[model samples]
Target chain A: MKISEIGEFGFIDEIKDNTLFNPDPVVIGIGDDGALYKTTQGMEQIAVIDTMVENSHFIIGRTGEWYDVGYKAVASNLSDIAAMGGIPTHIVLSTAFRPDMDVDDVIALYKGIKDICRTYKVNILGGDTVTSQEGAVITVAAFGEIEAGKALLRSGAQAGDVVAVSHTIGNSGAGLDVMLHGADGYDELKKAHRFPEPQIALGRLLVKHHCHSLNDISDGLASEANEIAKASGVRLVLQYEDLPISEELQRWAAASGTQAGKFVFTGGEDYELVFTMSSADFAQLQAEFPAVTTIGTVEAGPAEVVLCQGGKRELLPAAGWTHF
Target chain B: MKISEIGEFGFIDEIKDNTLFNPDPVVIGIGDDGALYKTTQGMEQIAVIDTMVENSHFIIGRTGEWYDVGYKAVASNLSDIAAMGGIPTHIVLSTAFRPDMDVDDVIALYKGIKDICRTYKVNILGGDTVTSQEGAVITVAAFGEIEAGKALLRSGAQAGDVVAVSHTIGNSGAGLDVMLHGADGYDELKKAHRFPEPQIALGRLLVKHHCHSLNDISDGLASEANEIAKASGVRLVLQYEDLPISEELQRWAAASGTQAGKFVFTGGEDYELVFTMSSADFAQLQAEFPAVTTIGTVEAGPAEVVLCQGGKRELLPAAGWTHF
Candidate 1:
């Protein structure tokens, strides 16, 4: 059967079931966005490899500058590290380039990657390259380190915990939609789509604050909330009206007759942090991070995310952007 | 300006020069088959990622069983770890598959990979999969560890060292040739092409014995020998007559009117270890490893490799299979 028929989510399930690495050192593997292993030095090693295929996850020029592609590539992996509240140290870039690609473009791509690496103080230790028959396939494998027992996980939320997001959501999806239609004048949205900033600082702060459960919004807020809920065996009740939709996304949603809440729930590639913690911790986090918005609370119930508003409660569709 | 115009060698040179890694932990990076780094635990971390594109380094059905492609993918990365004389601990497989591919085939491929991982006791920690635009692109990024200051490098050959290979050469190239042409026989050659075994035990043994410089014959004997000579700043005079050619390749070469020596020199995908060490060390290795074949000697001179036979000498062309 074709992969499109099987669907990316089903395939991910197959991979999770048959995952081959369940060694003693592996603290968590295959289920989350990244894998975690305890190193010999008593530190938790966080590893994540994200594959970005041309015309799929990214486009050569449709999204942004050549440098943006490179910047985003590293940024995505760093975001995975951020999900685990780790600091990236090493990366290996395995890229398959089209044979006829210009040498300068590849260099520019590398420069974009290097620029970000320079900013993050991570080293591009090594990588291998292959020639693709057509489009480029760039995969970045990033390695990070965190203090033992300090790395946050999805399976740690508790009942009565306050659910919050690191910042405003839906800009990336809005930006991408605008760009695809060639709509004018939303540079911030386009920038957000082109380069979804990795919330490294926020991740570190969350770890320090001892947040209960956390995951990055790579897919969508709803999907991430569901993940944390399912893994932690709790119910997440999201207040639909409380979602932190940006003014830009709000204006665009209004013009398009689309609910900003739905976009915030279903839009992907946001790269924000969705976390749950104690009310005190959430208060402290909101004070420290002015952009954070508490949009929900955890409850003792079935493992799912429910949207509550205006005396009506409904289970979310578990819908999100899957690669398939 | 196209990659084909720049050529793989030129592009590699550009990458080596513009490499973004030069940290205190990096012992060797970029230019070698794998990068070596000193970890905080004082162990040397060896990392290498190799990309195998469809119809380029491998074929879906032409190679052999569905498992051969997967087996060879992991083996290639293992070969790089072998080159460094390190013990592989973990691997991440990033594969791009055609959407029309069968789910069963993917499972079979994973089974093949799992078989090898089980044998080597290496963990398949994690990987990402993508939809291929055309054919499958399978890449393996391997990580290994060796005691600090014990890893071998292409730059460790001494002036008076004796050059040798771990086993017979040219079988993989000849096997691929036989497979490409419609031939039924030459099972050994076909096996060489399909499931090239990584010399893990041999590599570990060599490291224990303190082999000076080592490389794997992924791009033919001549190219690997040249790498050692160039990196070590020594002249390598390979006695063509002493080159180890399997009886199968020799017979095929004789029937096809191809020089067995040249086949040994230019044939690639032969996952054998090529090393240079002191003459005394070479003799000891030959005795311990009965199959070890000494084929050349390193001398103080210009950094180059020359093929010599019966007092006649000529510069060997620095040619091998490059993607471009």
Candidate 2:
């Protein structure tokens, strides 16, 4: 039938009826503001989004490593699902490029994606590729499933929970400084900045042991701690002396005369997990990995984050990452 | 312990162990390239992606209506899920804009998204918003579920199956012509161009009834027919006289001295569904909507699409849409 004969609404109804399922998974279908779905039994879903733009997110020429761009873009999203203590199954990617974008960069980018997908054994399924006016824009959406009622949240922290981080915090930050300043020889820090790994496995361990709360440190530690504090409605007191700083990061900071401690507190894009758990859970985790630090403690107080040592008290700078 | 003290690999190890889910929905965790997930029983996942760019995809000023841009962006993705005979559940959007983008325009753009999400009952789970160097880039990743055994692939057509379309064609192409020419009074065609609804219901019904191969008419019918023919390893013989063309499209074409038939066949972005089913299924679908025309048939010929009526036969135009 011609859609025009029945008008727009009639045409829409035809479209709607064509999608009806027998033993449907639909809780609600067309004619609403959103589609409703029946959830799978025994599973909760975890999702993550990552965005990459030309010039702003990554350089296209000279300093741009197109392969790493693709690798890290996918990693960033996967990390979020990992942060939530969930397993990822499917990923969708969207790429927008100007008409003039080199074909080689596109191939390299897809290679990076394929490499990661093969490693994770996740399917690409489908995605969008369109023409942009100028530079390229890439966004990846990653999805995973987890045990229902068990996916970790940032609001699960309690007073007396040991504030712990999965790994040292300042390497990525230091790496970024090295890159921006065009310095040399901190190859470890540079790699950390370009290809920081997300703590997916560590996240699952925390969930398995009934850890109180979990978060990925995509932003700096200070901002991440603030998020956990606000979400859980508690205060956090971290030890500056206990802040995780890599040897390479400390060396780079000393050579550059940059404050290594502040870098741990303020840098961004680390893609690590900053979490809290009971000392017992922490101890169990420590048995497996002795370097997991009990850096602070959750406390019953206003929703704020502070750092101190040597019998002094001070507020940590709100070192939130703001991308432009 | 500080991540730096343990080094990069050690930090990654800690991250990996932490995400390891006990009773893991995580079939695979960190150290892999992508995360692996276990599936929900009896269901298959369907995903779709839509990308909108500045200048090329939509005009940012003058003729541009930000609200419609937002609405159409979301609708386009939903339409793809519908095309696959799946029930859409979650949608994630990633938008890149410049620092100078007006706050009100952003509000209006989101309102457009809000309007459609409200209509569809879709929750905007979460997405990434980042700054761009130039114009706005919005990409949506939409997810849906279908009965695993029942997903309708593009390779299911068979000889003698009757070909059918869910609605009339050509209106959207005509609408675009009108908009580009700045002509007035063809609001229906214009609306068809600006806000074509996705055919979710029709897709579901097709799957439930066990139809053969199916395809959405995003490109012109000619290209879609070619896709089906190529995928299914069969040939399509369409009756040119039987093509569904709306009155508005006809009027616009007549006024412009454009062949309405060519518009129905060669112009793209119609967002209709074209499929082949048994005569029995066609009869069943037709009983509800008499306008469902048997415009063509499938046959054992070279894998190509031909248009014929009475004594005339010609190869269909290769006019599919292409993106860079």
Candidate 3:
């Protein structure tokens, strides 16, 4: 059945029925003007919102399933909360639906959202749904909590801090290219693109290890590094040889005759945590998280990012995906 | 200049400059993955999201100014919080913009949002801005706080409760008609449609007076009353003659040969609080809020609504706006 037949309230009722995972802290959930929830004393609140527009963020049934679209929408917002060094507790979802859209696809979208929230122990609070004239738009507002004055910020990096990333990068961008170009093989790359995991555990570990600065690789490593450098008023020098590139991504790029570094620097939506800390802290963290890799160092200089390769140095432009 | 010239981050910088009205609770504002704020002890949190799409909620530069669109977007969410008997504290705005759109128009929209937020002493947290393939889409997620266990809900109206509204209704609907049809007179009605205020004070007062149930009128009286009736499992009987219709609306309906009651029952976007309470409590509330009008009563019956006029009664259909 088309969404037009079900109407706005009917669709909302469907969402209400499917949502409500992790409802312990929730006094009110869906079917209200606003949702009410209990707050723990002395804890700081973190809120973030992310929107995924159809045809721009994803092409339904082409790039991935509607389920993937829903899953990624929640993942993106959760990643933001993770970047803040917080534990996500609840989310509110807002959507703009086209009248002629199929109801089953929308339900699948909610199923994906529900599954993710359930996995993360996050409650679906409330959201708004309205009719749109064209493609669907999904916006998720996520809320998390952190200890008082313990949020990880981009402006906390100091000179002599070591820069590290949670895991290998550029796989998501490579996966997108594989889907868009319809290249055969590389199932792992495709899965990386379709289901990028939020680095919530790594973020908490970084905070516990006293990491000074943090950012998520949503707009590529280049842009995220620049953001940290500018916010902290320090320079970041990345070793090109040390940049973490997955073996699968390297093979896919080499087979496709593409430069792997291009995806590493400019590819977006990797959903990995890039952070800075002292060398001693990094050593302790790397012992616990064996996959974490150090690729850069902070220096006392103008706010900038530089790449070093073969004893050569060059400035890195803040080039990534520009929405406009 | 078009937004495409400056890019997405550039537009975000402009918004970052204009926001930040109340900064006491904000630990981290804009320019981050997520915003952080301190939560007060012993207070519950409230969250709601509302979206406005071009040619759907309002026609920019025609039905209202871009500023009004922005103002109403925040007002709608604020009204939701008010219905829950909470004090709005922070908001995150998410917009999907057409790249070719003029930057000045978007700035005006933010100006509207800024002014309303300033009036309410609410802080602008952070949001996401993306490129849409079509017209502008604005979604605002509002956060508020109320005392523990004191939020007003829709399912609390018991039998023998009186149904009341905060103020006159149907003016906004008449105003929209005037603008859509290009009628010569009714400037007051036009203003009503352009700038509807959220009844925050009345909502707080209702909670103070121990009102049983509450809802905001966004989808007209018939629909909102039906929601309350169904949620509370009680029947509502509204006296047609007792609905608080503004004199200007009555004049416009008479001049335009339209039924004023039609607008009262089926028109939406009034943003007034409609609630139910015992007659004794209602008397106490009415003494302080003279503008509050009694139009109905809750009766022990199956969930339904009946309109009574001149010794005749008819079932009131839940016919308002159907988004799909």
Candidate 4:
């Protein structure tokens, strides 16, 4: 039947009439942007977003990594909450699939997703699935909650706050470059491209330590530092020599003739934490754990990210990754 | 860099480490199925589902009706709420597209969806978009709320209750058959295929007057009635002569040499309301609205949906649409 005949309102009414709704706490169902459920008093809520596309996100023949695709899809959203200091709980998956796509592929996708959910003790709960003349699409809305006073934001940096990174950078981006160019380091670079990790435990630790402010280095360190600067309303001075680069990434970059420095600074999709803390705390943290380094400090004036060499400060160029 | 190399846990850890979390409410994130959010003593939650597909759900060539396809996508979901006797409020769209699908087509789809949302006082809150190698896919998750104790279900039927139908039936199914056959009477049947009206207000009225059991007729009257009967655990005896068939539908069916009875009984996608209520209340409703008919009666004994003809009761044949 023509959808217009039912009209939008009419169609909604029909679906509600057809389905059964549980009636414990919710007063209404099937007529709002988000289903409403009862909650306890003084509780905070968590929210996360993730998107998936067909060809760009997954290529059938070329991607023998379907499992990775499914795993990454969920993990990406969960990372968003971890950054917020919230515990992961329930997820809603919204998806569309073409008729031609084998049901098995979908089964594999869900299997991977379910695996992660089971490991983490999270509920699959509910979601919507539809057919599309276009390709397959997946969007997940994950919910989490944190203590009332401890949710983190991106704007809490202070001057003399030590900058710490969770891991080496540029691997994912370099991996992508290698994959596209068919470079010599096929296996290593492909691995980086397919499976970059998010550091949840460290984020929780930072929250526990009352670290200044932080954000994931999605676009690149240069861009992420700029974000911290903008949010904290402070200037950041970086020492390029202090930046960490993995040995594998350095070898790949060297053989490919791609500057490891540029990759480290501008390459994104690292999914690593970039955070700030006071100088005193930096010393204390260093005394306790040697891996953390003071890469930069927050300054009071001139909101900018500057690279300090010897005694001179050079402005860092901005080159954020573009999706489209 | 293969995806497994990064590993699910590792990838999530990286994402979390790179993010800044507020310690106020969370123990952790990034590694769980769902995000944990703070709870409250009382909160209202709702859930709704919608689906869309490519060829079967939409058209692509000269024969294809893209605009109508978009319209139907949203209409179907909206109809769900209309049947539930509630008002729709929010929608989350999940879409998948092939590599070749035009960006403009995607935009048009959203425009159609947005148009409906605007009319229904619903908001397009958040959704995920992804790519697929096959065709396009779209799913919408809509949510709504109503006053406590006002939501409707399909398990409230009682014997001696009257059966009522909203508007006309068999139009959409006949319309589709007409279009598929490449027959003449294009306009009337096409309207049925392109524009369906969901009976929202009538459903609300049914709820208001305390409907015993209710459901929308998507898989034809007989099929949906069967659902009501099954769910309510009762037998239903329908009067064949009382089946509502539009004059136009009759003409179209006659001209096409299709049985009107079959169209009314077995054809699906009607989106009409089929409800049962106490005889006294049904009589009052029928008095107020003369168009409604007592097409069926709930009975004790084995759960069966039978049609009565010349004092003889025969089982209704199973003939309806199946999504899978």
Candidate 5:
């Protein structure tokens, strides 16, 4: 009867399983990455909130800059807004620090958050401050305005849509491995983990260019692709040989005794854009956005993401961080 | 310096002192009871986020029911929305719980929240769930909307305006004392603390009736009155003889060797409406809302609140719950 018995995913499912709709203004409520509320002025607004805890999400001793922690905290929420193809406009930060925390440390963390907001051209409107007997708890609520029909969704991918991933993958997973092992040739990966950049502009571009479906790459390409496939009622076939992994990632994966191809396929925290595009549009998109790589094809079948590896198609296991 | 060295209010000041506002459509930001953002549809929206930590905000072995805690959590946030004269629409709840939490117990808590939201007609939109190594952390972000120019403010009270308290005060404070005392005839007072009702409808009525310069009496009537006085650049003279104290509160205060009237005057978490109105409008309001009490008046002077007791006036001290 304890919480762990149901697990974190079960709890999330319990909350979102219902198809309840709020009164007149809310377009979408609990199930999506964010909620869509229609403004009385006929504008669609997106709101997303997420929280991160110390020692649970990040250890203080490893990658110990409070600034980096702040960046990760805000980036997590920003990624949700980006998934909706909305431009984040304002953020409210609520934090509870332990009694022993230094004032300057918290200030530096806020500064780091402000720097990220500055880079994104958003404002930190307001928040709350309270002390806790437990460790640090930070919650961020972000709001953005999106055009009436432009927000991307997980349920929009159709059969025959091509799966495309923006830029490379596995940098954060390799970075975390380096932080754990103190290994060489993975410093850049570690930085990538600490400060993952959210592709907001790319998300907007995808929505504008009529991408079939969109989701940010947070919990690995395989896991996220599986989510899109399940939500969209389609099957996905990914080409592992077509994966764009960096040379440093290959070097680090080799030193760690991990397969570079599998690392790129199943690693997480990339914060890259993984989206589905129409076959005709995909051809035109490839000629323009060279950073985008065609990873797979959507098909009408049971929801699954398979990797074409070693001339064989195999089901990819889900191996990302489960926050709960 | 340690957080204690900075103190609770000092910590809040330090956190918000340098917060720069790039208000694109922000009506009011940090330093208010809540953040006010002008919705894209030109309606005024109120958003407030607050966190409650186990052992810090409440004792684990308290006499109150878990349901009471859940209700109080939502009520506190709803009070903030009500203070801004906005109608509660949606709330996002982020919770982190230790592994020991019973699933049924959490469901009961959720039921309590659902009951209150149903009563207020607010929807539970979206939030996050995470496992905690420590005790539970509950953060609620409540959002509401009001007409563009109808949101009352603390800075709109003018000199010569009548200052009033919406109802009897200090019942929640007395209720807390009852919980700490463990035995008494203070059942109603204690219940008041556990499940305090927010003056949402009353606030809407006041705004509709053109009342100016309003705030909810959360941090004691005296503390909040002082806030209004300072924000409005007016002085407040509160007659102690006119303070409203419940009969049960008086009986409990006598047993505890405390001044019941003084507690009602300065104790916190009453969730009552406090506002100033023009003398002419005050007469009409008295006829409309007979439950309201006119306890003070605004004057042109140095911004401060004074207590008028036994024909003597003295400066009121700021004393309430300090969370740092």
Candidate 6:
């Protein structure tokens, strides 16, 4: 069987079962945003690695700049830590590129990385630089820390838990469309696609408020919700009208003859937090984070997601971006 | 300027100058096999990442099995921690490959990783698998731990220190030649190339023996020796006759009409350790590890390495493998 038959998540599931040889230090091993391992008496270290291949993740010169490529690479890894409600502390970066690549472009890439590291107070550790046969490949391995038992996992949602998102969804997806199709007026969408900010502060706040489940919107809300549902062995019911789609994305979708809800559900790389919590906790959190919008609720049922519109319900397929 | 103009080490030098945004936790940052950072009051964490591109590092199915590729990837990262005299505990693996690759082959790759992780008692934490447009790329980020002050560094060598290596050198280089040229009657050399072992035990022993500077022979003996000399700000005089050369490698080199010293000096990926220590400590370590061989001595002079043979001395240039 080809790996494409299994898909990315299926490939992960295939390798995830027998990975921990010495399981003593591992609090949470494979199949999470990051691996959580016991470090000190009351602290756990989270390690996550993400790789962006040329053309697969971004077009260096065309997407925005080499700086933007570097920025997005670090942002995506930081988002994983945010999904785990952890404080990112350090990162090691590996870049594989052609020898003929300009040194100034590489320096610009590092400048983007350095700026983000400074903003997050993350130290740049050591990494490898090697020659690639073709396009460049950048991999960042990020390390973070969280208090013991304070991590928000994908498997903690309970029936009646309210599902919410930290920011308006689909802006990035519309931004990508704008960049690709040359839609003249959507600077907000273009910037959203170019430079995403990981929701670290919101993640910490959710964990403090005892959020039940959390995921980062790297693979879109539909796929992320399905992951939470499967991991938690529950059903998610998302209200179609309740999804927080941005005005710019909606307007762009209307002008382009596309569905805004499609972007909200299946367009990935938003870098926003999607989480579940008790209704009371959601209410308390909404006051502190006014932009947080309720989109769904957890239910005790088969592991799947459903989208409800007006008076009809339909299954939400996990059609989010899969590499394979 | 193109990165190739400055070369791999030059590119590293370019990025090494300013990386640490938060300097408190960092004990050592760039320009080393691994980054060492303070994790707890008395413990430091060692993190290293290595990437292997398809044609650059290994050609799948051409250079042994897919298993060998996976094993070597993890082995290379583990070797970095070994160079730091740390106990490797965990690793995160990332792979970018064509989606049409066989699932069984990927499983075989993971089996190789699993086998090595079990042998070292290191846990497979988490990783990212993505689609690459071209040939496969594998990256491994390894983490290890060492006592606060017991970690060996490349800058600790002093004048009068003895330089030694844990095992005979150039076997892997010979093995690569055997594989590439289809040379017969050298199974040992082939095995050395296919499955190079990290010198973790020897590294631990060296640290216990208060060994000073240390490096793994991934970029040949001359390059590693030069790194030690430069980092420690001392001159090293290597006795050419005392350099350990395997009998098989020597015989093979003779049969192939190639000088065996060429491989000994510039053949990389050996994974054995080269280290320095006070003469007294070297004597003590030799008693415990009889295979260890003294090949050189540190001298008070400019940071450089000299090859001495038959009362003649010549400068040794770092003509090891550069990715470019």
Per residue, candidate 4 scores C-alpha lDDT tens digits across B48-87 of: 5656667656556422365666666666766666666656
Between candidates 2 and 3, name the one with more favorable lDDT: 3
- The DockQ of predicted model 6 stands at 0.22
Residue B142 local lDDT, model 4: 57
**What's the DockQ for every one of the candidates?**
0.18, 0.21, 0.87, 0.23, 0.15, 0.22
Clash totals for all models, in order? 0, 56, 0, 133, 0, 0
Candidate with top lDDT is: 3
Q: B40-147 in candidate 1: lDDT tens per residue? A: 575656667778887888766676666888888889888888888878777766777776666566666777787777778766665666677788888887777776
For candidate 5 chain A, the 10 contiguous residues with the lowest summed lDDT are: A14-23
Candidate 3 lDDT tens digits, A130-191: 88998999999999999898999999999999999988988899999888988888888888
lDDT of 4 at A287: 64
RMSD in Å for all candidates: 11.5, 10.6, 2.5, 9.6, 11.6, 11.5
**Model 4 chain B: worst 10 consecutive residues (lDDT sum):** B15-24
Give candidate 2 regions above 4 Å deviation: A1-41, A61-64, A320-324, B1-41, B60-64, B320-324
Colliding residue pairs in candidate 3: none
lDDT of 6: 0.79
Please provide, for model 1 over A7-104, each residue's C-alpha lDDT reduced to its tens digit, 9 standing for 90 to 100. Answer: 33443443233222224434333321122233457565566777788888777667666677888888888887888777776677777776566656
Per-residue CA lDDT of model 5 for B105-202, tens digit only, reads 56556667777877887666556666678877888887777776677778788888888878888998788778888866677887778788988887
Taking all chains together, each candidate's TM-score versus the true structure is 0.86, 0.85, 0.97, 0.70, 0.85, 0.86
Name the 10 consecutive residues with the lowest summed lDDT in model 2 chain A.
A14-23
True contacts kept of each: 0.33, 0.40, 0.91, 0.45, 0.26, 0.44
Residue pairs with backbone overlap in model 6: none
* Residue B66, candidate 5: C-alpha displacement in angstroms: 2.5
Local error of candidate 5 at A164, Å?
A: 1.2
- Taking the tens digit of each residue's C-alpha lDDT, what string does model 3 give over B22-50? 78889999888899998777889999999
Clashes in candidate 3: how many?
A: 0
Residue B238 CA error for candidate 1 (Å)?
0.6
After TM-score superposition, the amount by which residue A109's alpha carbon in candidate 2 deviates from its true location, in angstroms, is 1.3
